[model samples]
Target: MTLNPLSTPLCVVQATISQHGERAQLVGLSMPSAPFGTLPWQLIGLANYIVGCQTSDTAPSPETFTAHMQARATSAIPSPATLYPYTPWHDGRVRLLLDVTLGPAKVLKWPQASLVIMEQESGSGSCDWVRLSRERTAERILTRTVWEIEAEAQLLAGRLREAPDPSTSSLLEVAQKAARWARESRKAARAALTISQAARARHALRMR
Candidate 1:
């Protein structure tokens, strides 16, 4: 979909939970530009690019993959393989959080992308990954999971509210909106988690 500046950008996340359910990891995609103008199909393209790069020893060039994904985006039918497992959560942008169970292959094959793992209980600490925030330097290409992102949004909104300058009004407005979105997103994330857990339970029972 074509998006304007006023339109909320869609942020897609590929999240993986461990077998023991003690920790969670996320797949972060590198964007060509700021997410403002991104299309829905392009998000799918990003996920496809990651799979293409990681699944094979020799990875396709980003350009080649972009072309391929763009072509695939034209299909009228959406593929379940490409569909995200979790319902999307909206913060400053619309977040499409996808889920998967982390398997034996823990290594990230893509050089440009990275996997960030976090404790399910603590929701703290990460190795080789950075939280998604505006203050992050341009060189870094990774983003944290939904919870962290939502927390950041709330913190930013609070800080904006504390600013004494009248000039911050517009910024504060945006921040407040983001905070509200974060809360709504959290609700969606919780619902998604419950559903995911139930589905996993069913699968385990069937395997017995």
Candidate 2:
């Protein structure tokens, strides 16, 4: 019997931000071996260690970090501060997004798997990751951003709208609405980026 993707156990993916001075690069970690139904605290600790190790050579030793993470895990109730809702993957796996930020670092690495990092850009599809599976070679992952996702959704909505089937009209309407919302969100995000850049420029002038 085939199981519903929604009913599958949760798999957490870390969408980390590696900050270098004033710039931020988005990083995604592909953990094919990530155990299903992993706890939030455990994932958080793992993410911290991964980010720490990648971001700096001076990062705390694995033993030290593990001890600290363990202490936090047992002492407090883990909150969804960095966690996002579940998104079902095409492969029938559900993914939970964990947002994390790492400070300035000169180098980044993941010994076990490849690390794909992309600098944020202005246009859609500029900072997104696309993972592809190949039968002959290792899995390949690329960067993707929210803007690209919205753009793709809008394009898909357009195609659905043009479909010849009459029964799809209702579905098309829903898709169009979602596409509109995504477009608005993209606009707001761009505006926010503009404001942030302006603020940084002003600060730079003040410092000078």
Candidate 3:
């Protein structure tokens, strides 16, 4: 069955600033992608790992989404993650189920894809257990963050590209440069935070 785009799962992976000064809420989604379908709890497990717990149905950060949308040229999309359900038919395939909502209100409206995961029997095979592959989680988070960075970077670059289209004053040029710099700097700052946090972790580990 095709998923209603109005309510696809939004796996919110709460990124606590990585060891690389990077921060991103890696989202794992299990809508109808094209082939993967069926994994709901598994998706929850991963969500639990990243976004804490699957509490009240959370809505998209409109402000955040809006801002990102404004920078459209190279938007990396709000694609969180893909998950599917482990159906009997999906013996050797991985499956995931998600609760996704579209639009600002997420009023349940869109053509949600029910894609299937590659291969079968790929999951930890937990019924209700929240399977969190630390390695997979870390990998997904890192890759997701990089994707976001690239998207934002492209947006910033696009803005710069257009700055000269309307004849920006020297001051405007300076300001635009500063704006671009700030966006990149924020990303850098996040990396720094990650490094700082990691150093502390290592120190604590050594103390132990």
Candidate 4:
């Protein structure tokens, strides 16, 4: 189904989850994009970043894309062989919304399609684009997880070293020790990623 919001330049695509191959599933997605004049890359990028899900092929039609979104919702659960969705939360309000931009392209017919659209290609650079935002979520998650673990480890180690008697160490002591180890491990991981990203940037520059 299509939900035409009063929001200018953005068409909200709302679809009931369509399923195939013995898996009856339900999914909902909200993609924010220009209803027309949007680029495929923009759509792809926005969807990937905002939704954190994988899509096959470009979005050919509104209906088909909706199906894809539905499948994403289903795969989110522990059902079968689907990739993990990049959904940050299960809340409906936070769900990814699709905004279809009506570019210069036109579709002559309707209702004959089971999918919102058929296969089509952009005329080079004609995409609805948006600067990636809040994109560091993955890196942030990694960093935070590592940092917390590392901090815990350090705390434990500090406690242990100051322990009046190492022989009397008990569960709490053991936990603090583990936390200390985790903190260190996290620190190393954070550093590795930072170094890797920097190197990657350098490599990309050289390639460019």
State every prediction's TM-score relative to the real structure.
Answer: 0.30, 0.32, 0.23, 0.24
Give per-residue CA lDDT, model 4, range 18-72, as digits (tens).
Answer: 2232333333344333222133222332233212221121223434444454554
Model 4, TM vs. native: 0.24
Q: Give one digit per residue, the lDDT tens place, for model 2 in 1-208.
A: 1223344433333333333344444433222223322332233334445434543444333333334443543333222222223332332343333333434332223212232222211224556443432111001111122233345446556766677555445544543553454445334434544666688899999999
The worst-scoring run of ten residues by lDDT in candidate 4 lies at: 103-112
Worst 10 residues of 3 by lDDT: 105-114
Tell me how many clashing residue pairs each candidate has: 0, 8, 48, 40
Q: Which sections of candidate 1 miss by over 4 Å?
A: 1-163
Tell me the lDDT of model 1 at 65: 41
In candidate 3 the C-alpha lDDT for residue 164 amounts to: 51
Model 1, range 106-193, lDDT digits (tens) per residue? Answer: 2333323333221111113453232332211101211222234345446546666687555445544543454454445334434544
Error of 3 at 196 (Å): 2.8
Q: What lDDT does each candidate get?
A: 0.36, 0.36, 0.32, 0.33
**Cα deviation of 83, candidate 1, in Å:** 26
Model 2 regions more than 4 Å off: 1-163
